[model samples]
Target chain A: MDMIRRTVLKSAGATGVVAGLLATGMLKPTLAYADDWNKAAFEAKNMDGALDGIGAKGAADNKDLLVKAPEIAENGAVVPVDVTSNIPNTTSIAFLIAKNPSPLAAQFEFSNGAVADVSVRLKFAETSIVRVVAKADGKFYSAQREVKVTAGGCGG
Target chain B: MADPMKIRAQMKGDVAEVRVLMSHAMETGTRKEADGKLVPAHHIQNMTVALNGKTVIAGQIAGSVSKNPVFGFKVKGAKAGDKVAVSWIDNKGDKRTDEAAVA
Candidate 1:
């Protein structure tokens, strides 16, 4: 009876594993849902090219997008940036450092009921406007704040 | 061996707040050492978060990210005891994965 019970437990565990995978839709190829990282955007030397690369070329400034960053960053090597968007259905948030060798710092895509809030530390080449662009409902909205750096982080 | 990434996932009113701290040098490849050799780019290029084996967040990060980066986000519908995992791939193809139980 003990051996039979052990076998039953093993099959139950296997069934649970299969059920979990089915419920999570893991059997499907979710790779199509994930957008590939845009290398061109990160390598763009100019803001326009970077913006165009990410399909955010004509983003309009929106008040709902809140960017929390220090007005004066004593160490350019590490600047803390917090971005929050109240716009409904936000799908992504991107960071751009105007004066960095590569203007695009990071791009984040939200899925599976993730909220539209992100925090990251970025390096700055010099004092520059830090821009946060949020995509919601297939429209791009952006807001910028100037952060003063006492020392450049990008080998200045 | 490199240190394991530190991760925390706590549920608050059906939303799991996930925070991850990864240890890396994040060299931008532009900095020169005292010997005048340029540091090769060695930063996390991709990161992803999964809840209960389902991806919730995926990100592309550049070398501008600071060394030992920290990231935080929220995932809806996660509860206490749910499995939350975080993984990252660096520019040199080094990868790390760590998991935590939502609390």
Candidate 2:
């Protein structure tokens, strides 16, 4: 069981590199990607960010998306998260941390008749915005919440 | 190891309540040891739950979850003694599958 979990963990870690793949062209650019559903703002410290990083600036009133994080993270090293969406025709979802080593956490895309709920664990170096964004039909919508990281959880 | 996933299934009328506890360190690739070496990022990537060989739930994931991830969902028209299977594939292509029957 440990062996299996270890493998899963290692694969889960590959997103940082997969997100980097577009930059190095280790993989082909997503020529088929649609712009409206593909957000770019939330990705970087600046505008020229990765497609996965962009999100709507504010979604305080968007009623379809649900974001959950502790008001205070007991361990900054590993924080728990849960996201769910009830928006019609939802096509994508993403998670971003305003103050991680990198802002991007993870992103997911849904196909025909897919469920819009997800949960995962992440690392936070400090207090940051926990943003969950969703693309519905042809428009982008998002919600940002804050998390306070107390102690670090990385191997350190 | 954080903790082995806790799995449970119950029946109330025709509803089945299924739950899972997955063990994961969920490292975010942004920390260092006392000696200052960066710890690699690790997390669970994909998970699917099936009822009696039919797909019921599937989701893409990343490392933004807590240690020992837990998820519960509802299934309609399920009966007691039906077999429900859960499978997970992490970022590195490691996959594990577990099954439980409704009681």
Candidate 3:
């Protein structure tokens, strides 16, 4: 018990030091964690570019990957999207709005026996194809659904 | 500062259905305020979920997501009485973490 307490205290002290460095601007905020935000991927203007930015180029269409989205979104500002993959050993799932100024919307990585299921709300600039890409077994599979946005979400 | 996320976890059979509601403006950095100045990009950049202290989902999000984003996922082999913790870090370095008991 004494050893565990000491270890915990040491970790706490280390965290405090890191936080202090961040507060003083000595350390970049993104470097505080292992996972860094991929800004370029999310800023890509086209579907292919976005996929390439995320190292998911040449993804093949697969029926096992399912993307569920509204056929017609009354409010383009908030469209619900859900994706599920039946493929085994799925590692990641990413959503893209093909017509948005920036196509990549969200990307999720799964581990520890988590199911390949994700639901998120996305914004659409206009009528666009909602695409979902799943990485499994070192390969990428994709599925898409067209969602007609009656109103634009990017502009007033 | 942002409001704490609301997380719910329930065991359906052996699967744990986790739902999270994150309170954020999700500003795209393009919108103009009343003063006609562009609002800087401020959105959740990363999210994580853990079941019984084991990470099950890690997500990277962008400003294209809708405001007050809602996310849902499923975790296999999760049982009642387990703990489900959800956390998110925004682009501005703000973070919030909240947990729920599996039911």
Candidate 4:
């Protein structure tokens, strides 16, 4: 707990210093880390509730995003997935596993000057809802897929 | 050892793509260990994602899933200059969350 707080504080200080420099014209130009979000607040018992908590709206009817997951997980330990979008100027990406002790599995930021892409590994407690949240132009959007696990992977 | 789930996502045009690999035992706690002790139930309850503080996608999970699951999805209407945040809380009362920016 203390360690987390210290880390947060240090990051805050660094951000403040950078902001000050930018304001004083001491720095040329660069992107900024978002300060208006918290990662621990949106967990829920189900999928829709979690989305509502994070202010995400699914574009299920939209044709811009594509998501894929295994129909049946051979083992309840590791499942692979992939998602791709044809949307222009993607700003952020993330993943979550519902049914695990922690719904939040992973997060990754993309370089503004680089392609909007991210990849990561996460732990799942069981077969659950997997969600990916994306932000573009200050708006929130997301995609979802279901995965099945066969064996016990966590304690093995 | 088995391979952990590998997940990846990319955004193009007006969509936010995402993916995940899940690692878990999904133990129902119905079985006993060698010592005859019943294992406790541990699983993920729910997960959610927000773009720029707005929740866009969510998932509901169950025990029927095998250990280590993989899932993927897409979010439409996304563009550049935004932030994506992901968070989850499990049945065991543990929670973890992280955020990424879109480009």
| Residue pairs with backbone overlap in model 1 | none
* Model 1 misplacement above 4 A: A1-35, A152-156
B4-55 in candidate 2: lDDT tens per residue?
4566878755567677788777665555788999887666656677778786
Per-residue lDDT, model 1, residue A47, is 86
Q: Mind giving the per-residue lDDT tens digits that candidate 1 earns over B20-97?
A: 999999888788999999886677778899989998999999889989999989888888999998988764446789
Which is the leading candidate under lDDT?
3
Clashes of each: 0, 18, 0, 64
Model 4, A19: alpha-carbon shift in Å? 35
Docking class of 2: acceptable
DockQ, candidate no. 1? 0.34
Write down the worst ten-residue block by lDDT for model 2 chain B.
B58-67
Measured over all alpha carbons after superposition, the RMSD of each candidate to the real structure, in angstroms, is 12.8, 9.0, 7.6, 13.5
Instruction: Report the candidate with higher TM-score, 1 versus 4.
Output: 1
TM for candidate 2 is 0.62
User: Roughly what TM-score does model 1 have, to 2 decimal places?
Assistant: 0.83
Candidate 4 lDDT, tens digit per residue, B28-78?
A: 445579999988655544556666777765554444234454545455666
Scanning candidate 1 chain B in windows of ten residues, the lowest lDDT window is B87-96
Runs of candidate 3 exceeding 4 Å displacement: A1-31, A152-156
For residue A6, model 3's alpha carbon misses the true position, in angstroms, by: 34
Worst 10 residues of 3 chain A by lDDT: A26-35
Q: Flag the better candidate by DockQ, 2 or 3.
A: 3
